[model samples]
Target: MDLFTSARKEDIARGAPLAARMRPRTLEEFVGQGHILGKGKLLRRA
Candidate 1:
């Protein structure tokens, strides 16, 4: 099935709490864990 659609994103955001909705889209946007999550890190690739 073709998941990860934009419509689904909107639906999820609509149902999510304000804190969850305000969360970052990627690890790069997320603060902390930087010492472990540097460029080409295993977690980033995962």
Candidate 2:
């Protein structure tokens, strides 16, 4: 990533709430909520 893009992302994250900043950027990094996101689930399939 370029320095400008990296700085922009860092600035955005710094301004966000802790919860928002801590949220997983990808489904693979997510946890819990298995009832909806578990394997074979409709949302997971989508």
Candidate 3:
């Protein structure tokens, strides 16, 4: 099978890892409590 299918199968077999569970699915969906990942703050500062 292709990489996408294989990865999905592995994900199903192993379930989501701790780090995977903590990943932000999208930019808007990210749970940003700290100012580090806040809206364009760091990027603007850089």
lDDT of 1 by residue, 1-46 (tens): 2566877987977999998888888778868787667788878777
Local accuracy of candidate 3 as per-residue lDDT tens digits, 1-46: 8999999998775786878777777555656544765667764356
Q: Cα deviation in Å at residue 22, candidate 3?
A: 2.3
Off by over 4 Å in 1: 1-16
Maximum-TM-score candidate:
2
Q: Candidate 2, 21: how far from true, in Å?
A: 0.5
TM-score of 1: 0.44
Off by over 4 Å in 3: 1-14, 33-46
Of the two candidates 1 and 3, the one with more favorable TM-score, higher being better, is 1
lDDT of every model, 2 decimals: 0.80, 0.87, 0.69
What are the runs in model 2 whose C-alpha is more than 4 Å off? 1-5
Give all TM-scores, in the order shown. Answer: 0.44, 0.46, 0.32
Q: Worst lDDT window (10 residues) for model 2?
A: 26-35
lDDT of candidate 2 over 1-32, digit per residue (tens): 99999999999979999998788988767787
What's the best-to-worst order under lDDT? 2, 1, 3
Error of 2 at 22 (Å): 1.8
